[model samples]
Target: MTIKWEALLQVFGATLLVTVLVVTLFVIGIRALSDEKKGPAYASFAGCVAVVLYGLSLIVF
Candidate 1:
């Protein structure tokens, strides 16, 4: 049986995108909790979670 490599590549790319999003949220959370420029950082962290979830929807379906 022959396996389709294109789907594999799509999955890999989506996975990488999700990783980047998670790391971005981590940085945002740290910066937000710190005593410097306390504003959009926290919101950004939340947004990151949403973004990752949205990305997963694409990968799963």
Candidate 2:
């Protein structure tokens, strides 16, 4: 069977992009919380959590 190099690279690129995006979001949430700002901090944390859960759902289904 022949391997599809282009598809492989596309998937790899997408995975890398998503991983970076999620980690960046998590870091932003932590930084926001550390700064002791209430409204935005909570919003950031909630957003991070939502993204994480969405990722998990993608993996499961």
- In order, the Cα lDDT scores of the candidates are 0.80, 0.82
Model 1: CA > 4 A from native: 55-61
Backbone collisions counted per model: 0, 0
Model 2: what TM-score? 0.73
Q: What is the lDDT of candidate 1?
A: 0.80
lDDT of 1 by residue, 1-61 (tens): 8888999899899789878878987787787778565576777777877887787798799
lDDT per residue as tens, model 2, 1-61: 9999999999999889878887887777778778877777777667778878888999999
Q: Candidates' TM-scores?
A: 0.64, 0.73
Model 1: weakest 10-residue lDDT segment is: 35-44
**Strongest candidate by lDDT:** 2
Candidate 1: residue pairs that collide = none
